[model samples]
Target: MDHILVTGGAGFIGSNFVHFLVEHTDAKVTVVDKLTYAASRESIADLPADRVSLVVGDIADQPLMERLVAEHDAVVHYAAESHNDNSLADPSPFVHTNLIGTFSLLEAVRKAGTRLHHISTDEVYGDLELDDPERFTESTPYNPSSPYSSTKAGSDLLVRAWVRSFGVQATISNCSNNYGPWQHIEKFIPRQITNVIDGGRPKLYGAGQNVRDWIHADDHSSAVWTILTTGRIGETYLIGADGERNNLDVVRQILAHFGRPEDDFDHVTDRAGHDLRYAIDSTKLRTELGWSPRFGDFEKGLADTIEWYQAHEAWWRPHKDAVEASYAAKGQ
Candidate 1:
């Protein structure tokens, strides 16, 4: 069986991708994660223990990366400091993990001469104007605004450099905001769902008008799998479901699903340097690779996501205290 190394496979998106790989392919999967406050091994509890190996470690550790890369057929890197709000509070970790950590992974992959697939966020394209009909494409120039996106942009450039200078077989996928089952409660969708279910109001930033193209994590995971198996080296693909919804609209939808009134949620001060909008065009991925999202409707997807969190409170409750503490410490 082909063996694949998945970095940050214990976190939200990373963990989902691991489950996808295990179920869809015959590949033996090894997951490397730092298991930070956000990551949980329970996310992957359904996988066969024997086939899935979980290594609790940092990605920047060169020796460990070299060993993992040397043995795996391919590497899917999903580990990074991903919260925009957290990045605004402190940028050092973003630089350390997103930029320097990615550099370390690149070096290891180069040394091993292994194929690498890197996960990136659409925030690297910076903000889209509210009236701008154009969607972000793969060829869109990088105009990262926040520290988090800027660091991610730096990492993307480094990956491109490695592919060009070192000729390392690598590809990158820039995807939009993802929401689905097992998402950490800190994100917008899950946080709202959990809070609403527990007789609390969902917090909205500013006037709640920031628009994001949200895709299901399962669809995003499947796209990652497609890129790993068949994508051309050095190519960057954009994966999105074209499901655009503003913060207020999203929360209201969740409220409606729960048979609660929209007025129940509270509006809070907007985040620092919040992107006004982000939308991605996945035409390249759709036309060239025949990859399109199976979950295309935000309403249905949102309802499904809410139901998942409702049914699995045990899985999410443990993280509630930490989530509150984090926000309280940030004074958000």
Candidate 2:
């Protein structure tokens, strides 16, 4: 596609994907974002103007959706209410953004005959028992545990229905936990990294046994571009780097990097309905698309991410207090 519309392009993964597109392809990108608290213009502030332009608007606005979809050759849907804790606190935004926002894009793309790729998270499959041995693949049954994931599940089903009923040319990818540059401080890795940078102890929740399959955002971006360009329409691809580490282990590693004791961090209350683990098996994506992740070593990737936050304190410092306050109120 020569012209692409990337929803949530001001946010973490979307902005990273936009940067990936600029370095790897010739396509022009149009970003549709509402600039939510989790989004930052600085995330994509320096991208070339001729190839990338930002349009401030809500994805749920159907009129805006149609106008933007018609102008682009493809749409990459990444906007969503994605935080589990926040979703548990108030599910209304998740329902509106993850469900209704996806519906709005599907309708617009269906009418415009635009190629579409939807970005989703593996949390929709819920948690696997820590020792379950089986990882989430494309055919995993939907067993979402939180409002955030359930709404994402609803959105994924909506895309499938549209493809079957209306022949909308679209593909979907559910990725593992992403950690890299420009990630908001609200996320786990960045939160811990920034906390250490500020001389604060890392916070661990309940015994910190929860596991996340980590993938660098750059890798996630490459895989999405692969699927958008080479993937079969109406098919779903799983994106992962096979990087799995538990929360306790991850926090200890972060503390070690900052010359703090492994047991220096505080243990806070875990959220209700927190899934125990998430792991993604990306064999299908690797076999079908010949895609491989470059960040094969989790520790190395984590170090690079920590370094990014350390060097860019200006990017995260302004938001740290508010984020910590929000978490404190939740008792987590």
Q: Residue 145 CA error for candidate 1 (Å)? A: 1.3
**Residue 80 shift from truth in candidate 1, angstroms:** 0.4
Q: How many backbone clashes does candidate 2 have?
A: 0
lDDT of 2 by residue, 166-285 (tens): 999999999999999998898899999988988998888899999999999999999999999999999999999999999999999999888899998989998899899999999999
| Candidate 2: residue 18 lDDT (0-100) | 96
What TM-score would each prediction reach against the true structure?
0.97, 0.99
Top-lDDT structure, candidate number? 2
| Positional deviation of residue 112's Cα in model 2 after best superposition, in angstroms | 0.5
Residue-by-residue lDDT tens digits, candidate 1, 1-332 = 38999999999999989898888888889999999978998888789987799999999888988998899989999999998888887899999999989999999999989999999999999999899989999889999998999999999999999999999999999999999987889998898888887888888887899999999999999999888888999999999999998998998998898889877887776788889999999999989899988898888888888888989999999888788677657544
Residue 292, candidate 1: Cα error in Å is: 1.0
Candidate 2 has which clashing residue pairs, if any? none
Maximum-TM-score candidate: 2
